[model samples]
Target: MSQRVVLGLSGGVDSAVAAYMLKKQGYDVICVFMRNWDSQLNNDILGNPTNNDPVCSQEMDYNDAKAVADALGLELKRVDFIKEYWDHVFTYFLDEYGKGRTPNPDILCNKEIKFKAFLQYAEELDADYIATGHYARVEHRDGDDVMLRGVDGNKDQTYFLCQLNQHQLKKSLFPIGELTKPEVRQIAHDLHLPVADKKDSTGICFIGERDFREFLKNYIPAKPGKIVDYATKKVIGEHQGIMYYTIGQRRGLEIGGKGGPWFVIGKEYDQNILYVASGDSNQWLLSDEALITGVNWISSTKPEGDFDCTAKFRYRQKDNDVSIRFINEDTIYVTFKKPIKAVTPGQAAVFYDGEVCLGGGTIDKVYHNNKELEYL
Candidate 1:
C-alpha cells in the first residue's frame, strides 16, 4: 500500500493544487477540512448582534472544499478545533492586546493550531505525514529536518511557521512550496477545481476580512483615550482606544489642520495616551535595538553569543541585517545594522540564515540608542 498523507484542504486555490500534487505523487491523499471557528457565536465589539446573514463564509469554504474533494475522487474528513483555537490562540491574542501590544494571531495559529492540533489529529488517522498549502519548505539537513523559505519569495510563509520545531517540520509537507502563486493557480485552473478562481484569503486566518476594530471591540472593551503629538506633547485628538492603534499607523487619526499627516509613535497604556508624530519619516518611530522573549529555536539549541543574520519584524517586510546576542535561555537582544521603524512589542522578530528559518520570539522591548522608549 502507498504511504498515506493527510492534506489540509482549506478551500483555497493553493491547497486545491497541493491536493492534486500529493495525489499525483502516489500518496494516498485524504482531504481534511478544519473548522477552527464558529460564526454563530460572533458579535460586534459592542455586544450587538452581527445580524442574520446567509451561510457564513466558512460554510461556503467547506462547500468548495467538498467540491474539490469530489472532483479529485478523494474522501474528505471534517474536524472541529474551535475549542483548541479559543484556548491556545484566541486567549493569547486577547491577552496581548489587553497589554497594549500588537500580536500576530496568524503566527500563533500556525504554531498552536495547524502544526499542533492538526498534526495530532492527522496522527490519529495513522498517516505518515500531514500537508498544507503554506508557502514554505521542509528539508532534511544533516541529521535533522529544517524549515526553509518557499521558492516564491513574495509569498513565502516561513515567517508565520517560525515557531515550528524540528519534530513538526519532520512530519509536515508543503507541496506547493516549490511553486509560485500564479503557477499554483494555473494548476488549479487546469484541474478544473472550483476554487481555482477564488481570491486569496487575507488578514487573520479564521476571521477573514471584517472591520478589525469592530471585531476587536467585542473582546477588548474600547476605552476612549487622548492622542498626543510627540513633538509638542499636546493633545491633538481623542482616540477610540489605545489598544486599537499600533505604532507607525497613519490612518484614522482624524487629526487634521496639523500641517502634516500624523503617525503613531508610542502609547502610554497606564496614562491611556496615544503618541503621534508628524511626517512619514519620524525619528521617534525608529528603533535600533529590541529585547525578544519566549524564543523557540527550531534546532532545539541556541546559537552562542553574538551572531549576524537577517531579521524581519513583520510579514512582507524586506529582511534587515542585524546582530543577535542571547540575554538568557528565553530572551535575546538584537541591534539592527540600520534603525528600523515600528518595531512593535508582542510581534515576532524572525531571524534567517539565507533560506533557513532560525526560529523567533515575541518582541518585548524596543530601544532607541541606549534608552528605552519613555512609554514602554
Candidate 2:
C-alpha cells in the first residue's frame, strides 16, 4: 500500500500544483480544506455595519478546492478549525492589539491551527504525513529535522513557520518548496486546475481581501486617540484608534500638509497616545537590540551562549546579521550588527543560519543605544 499523505488544498494555485505533484509522486493523496473563520462574524469589508449578509468567498474557495481534489481523484475532507483558531490564535491576536502591540496572527495560526489542530486531525485520518503549499522545505540530518527556506527567495515563507517544532517539521512536507511562483502557476495551468488562474489571496488568511481597519472594528471598539509628534511632543492630529496603527505605518495618518510623511514610532497604551515622527528614516523607528520571549527552537534545543546568525523582524525583510544570547529558556537578547527599523513588540523575530531556519520568538522589548524605550 502507498503511504498516505494529506495535502492542505487551500484553493490556491500553489496548493493545486502541490496536489498534482504529490499525486505524480504516487502517494495516496487526500485533500483537506481547513475552514478557519466564520464570515458571519461581522459586516462586509467596506465598513457597512448594516450589511449582515454572509460572505460567500469561503464557500467559493471550498468549491474550488473540491474541484481540484476531484480532478486529482483524491478524497476530499473538510475540517472546521474556527473554534480552535478563536481560542488559540484569535484571542491572543486581540489581546496583543489591546496591549498596543502588532501581532502576526498568521504565525500563530500556523503553530496553533494548521500544525497543531490540523496535524492532529490528519493523524486521526491515519495519514503518515501532512503537507501544505507553503514555500518552505524540511530536511532530515543527524536524526533531526531542519526547516529551510524555499528555493525562491521572493516567495519564501519560513518566517511564518518559524514557530514550528521538531515533531511538526518531521511530519510536514512542502511539495512546491523548490518551485518558483511562476513555475507553480505554470504547472497548475498545464494540469488545467481550477485555481490556475485564480488570483493569489493577500492580507489575513481568513479575513481575505478585506479592509483591515474596518474588520478590526468588528471586534475591538475604536477608541479615538491623539496623534502626537515624537520630536516636538505636540498634538498634531487625532487617530481612530491606536490598535488600528502599527510601528512604521505611514499611510492613513490624515496628517497631510505636514512637513514630511509621518511614521508611527511608538504607542502609549496608558495614555492612548499614538507617537509619530516625520521622515522615513526616523531614529526612533530604528533599534540595534531587542529582547525576545516565547522562543521555540525548532530542534527542541537552544544554542549555548551568544552566537552569530541572521534574523528577520518582519516578513519580506532582508536578513540582518545579529548576535543572540539566551537570557533564559524562553527568552533571548538579540543585538543587531546594524540598527533595524521598526522592531515592534509582539511581532516575531525569526532567526536563521543561512537557508536553515533557526527558530525565533516574539520581540518583547526594543532598545536604542542600550536604553530601553519607555512606551513599549
Candidate 3:
C-alpha cells in the first residue's frame, strides 16, 4: 500500500501546486481544508451589522479546494477548528493588543491550529504524514529533524513555522518548499488548477481584506488617546486606541507637525499616550539589546553558554547578528551586535543559524543603553 499523505489544500496557488507535487511523488494524497474563522459570527460578537453575502470567504475557499481535489482525483475533507482557534490563537491576539503590544497571530495559528490541532486530526485519519503549502523545508539528519529555509529566498516562511516542535517537523512535508512563487504558479497553470490565477492572500487570515483597526474595534472598545511628540513632549494629535497601533508605524498619524512624517517611537499604555519621533533614524527608535521570553530551541539539548547566531524580529526583516545567553530554560537575553530599530515587545524574535531555523520566542522586553524601554 502507498503511504497516505494528508495535505492542507488552502485555496491558493501554493497549496494547489503542493497537491500536484505530492500526487506526482506517488503518495496517496488526501486534501483537508481548515475552517478556523467566520466573518458573520465575528460580526455578531462585535454587535456590528454583518455582510449579506451568501457565501463567505471560507466557503469560497472550500469550493476552490474541492475543485482542486476533484481535478486531481483525491478525497477532500473539511474540518472545523473554530473553537480551537478562538481559544488558542484569537484569545492571545486580543490579550496582546490589550496590553499595548503587537502580536503575530499567524505564528500562533500555525503553532496552535495548523500544526497542533490539524496534526492531531491527520493522525486520527491514519495518515503517514501531513503537509502544507508553506515555503519551508524539513531535513532528517542523523536521527534529528531540522527545519530549514525554503529554496525561494524571497518567499521563505520559516519565520512563521519557527514555533513548530520536533515531532511536527518530523511528520510534516512542504511540497512547494523547493520551488519559487513564480514556479509554483506556473505548475498550477500547467495543471489547470482552479486557483491557478487566484491572488495570494495577504494580511491576517481571519480578518481577510477588512480594515485592521475596524476589525479590532469590534473586540476592543476604542479609547481615544493623545499622540505626543517624543522630543517636544507636545500633544500632536489624537489616536483611536493604543491597541490599533504598533511600534515603528509611520503612516495614519494625522499629526500636522512641523518636523515630521512621524514614526511611532513609544507607547505609554498606562497613560493612553502614543509617542512619535520626527526622523526615521531617531535614537529612540534603535535598541542594542532585547529580552525574549518563552524561547523554544528546536534541538532537545539547549546550548550550554552564550552563543553567536542571527535573528529576525519581523517576518521580512534581514537577519541581525546577536549573542544569546539563556536567562533560564525558556528565556534568553539577546545582545544585538548593532542597534536594531523597533524591536517591539510581544512580536516574535525568531532565531536562525544560517539556513537552519532555530526555534524562537515572543519578545517580552526591549532595551537601549542598558535601560529597558518602559514606555513601550
Candidate 4:
C-alpha cells in the first residue's frame, strides 16, 4: 500500500506549499486543518470586531487550504481539537503565568497538543504519517527517531520541536525542512495557491491575533506592586503585576532610575513584587549554573556522565557551550562556559550537539554560589 500523508494546512503559504510538495512526492496526500483556537477570540485580534464567523471557524484558513487541497486533488479533513488545546496548551499557558512562571506555551503545544493529538487523529483515520509546515528536520539513529534543526538556519525551529519524542519523530514529516522562506513562497506561487504570500504567523502558538497582555490580564488580574532595584533594594516605581512581566523586559515598565535603563531580572509572585536591575552590569541578573527539570530525552537516554554540549536557555538564543551532570532521574545541572544573562526560572534550557537536539526541561532555579556577593 502507498504511504498516506496527512499535512496540516494553516491557510498560510508554508502549509499550502507543503501540501503541494507532498503531493508531488507521489505520496497519498490529505490536508487537515486542526481548529485549535476559538474564532471569536482570534477575529477580535484581527480587528474583526463584528466576528460573524463562529468560534474556531477557520473559514478563511480552510478556504485557502481547501484550494490547495483541491488543486492537488487530495482529500481534506477538518478536525476540532479545541477542548484538547484548552486542556493541554491554553490552560498550561495561563497556569504558568498565574504562578509568575514564563512558560513557552508553543513548546508544550507541539509536544502535547498538535503533534500528539494530530498524530493520534491521523492514525485513527488510517493515515500512514503526519506532516506539517514546521521548519525542522527529523532523523533516525540507533532505531530511535530524532528531531534536529532545519537546513535553513535562519528559519530553523528545532527549539520548538525539542520536546517531541522518538515515536512522534518516527511518524512525522517536515516537507519544507530544506527550503528557505523565500523558496517556500516561490513554490506556493508556482503552484498558484491562494496563500502564496500569506504573512507568517507570529505571537501565540495557535491564536493568530489578540493582545497578549490584555488577554492574559483577563485570567490573571493585574495586581499593583513596586518595582525595586535588586542592588539598592530601593523602590523606584510601580508595575501592574509581577506575573505579567518576565526577565529581560524593559518596555511598559513605566520606571526610570539612575545608572541607565533597567530590565526586569526577577519577579516575586508571593508579594506581587517586581525586580528591576541594570543591564549595564553583567552580574545584574546573569548567572552560570541552572537546574533543569521535566526533561524529555528524544530518541534515547541521557549521555553518560559529564560531557560537552551547547545549551540554549531561551528561544531564538544561540546554543551556549556547556557541561552537564545528571542530578537525578529527571533533573540535570548545566553550567555555561560564560555567564548567560536573565536565566529566567520558568523557561526551558534545550541541549544540543551541533544540529542534534538531545532534550530540554523547565528551569527550576538559577544559582550563583560560586560567585561572591562581596563584589556588589
Per-residue accuracy of model 1 over 97-146 as CA lDDT, tens digit each: 88788899998999998989999999999989999999999996667788
What do the candidate models score in CA lDDT, each in turn? Answer: 0.87, 0.87, 0.87, 0.80
- Predicted structure 4: clash tally: 1
Error of 1 at 37 (Å): 0.7
- Candidate 4 residue lDDT tens string, 193-310: 7788778878788766666776665455678888888878898888887777878887788775456488887777777778877758466666888788988778466777997999
- What are the RMSDs of all candidates, in order? 2.2, 2.7, 2.0, 4.0
- TM-score of model 4 relative to the true fold? 0.91
In model 3, how large is the Cα lDDT of residue 23? 93
Instruction: Evaluate model 1: give its TM-score.
Output: 0.95
Q: Local error of candidate 3 at 331, Å?
A: 0.4
Q: Where is model 3 more than 4 Å wrong at Cα?
A: 43-56
Give the 10-residue window scoring lowest on summed lDDT in candidate 1.
45-54
Give the local distance difference test score of model 4: 0.80
Q: Write model 2 residue lDDT over 262-303, tens digit each, in one string.
A: 888889998999998886554677789999999988876778
Segments of candidate 2 deviating more than 4 angstroms: 41-56
Instruction: Give the residue spans of candidate 4 off by over 4 A.
Output: 39-57, 257-259, 369-376
Clashing pairs in 1: 45-217, 45-218
Ten consecutive residues with minimal summed lDDT in candidate 4?
Answer: 367-376
| Lowest lDDT block of 10, candidate 2 | 39-48
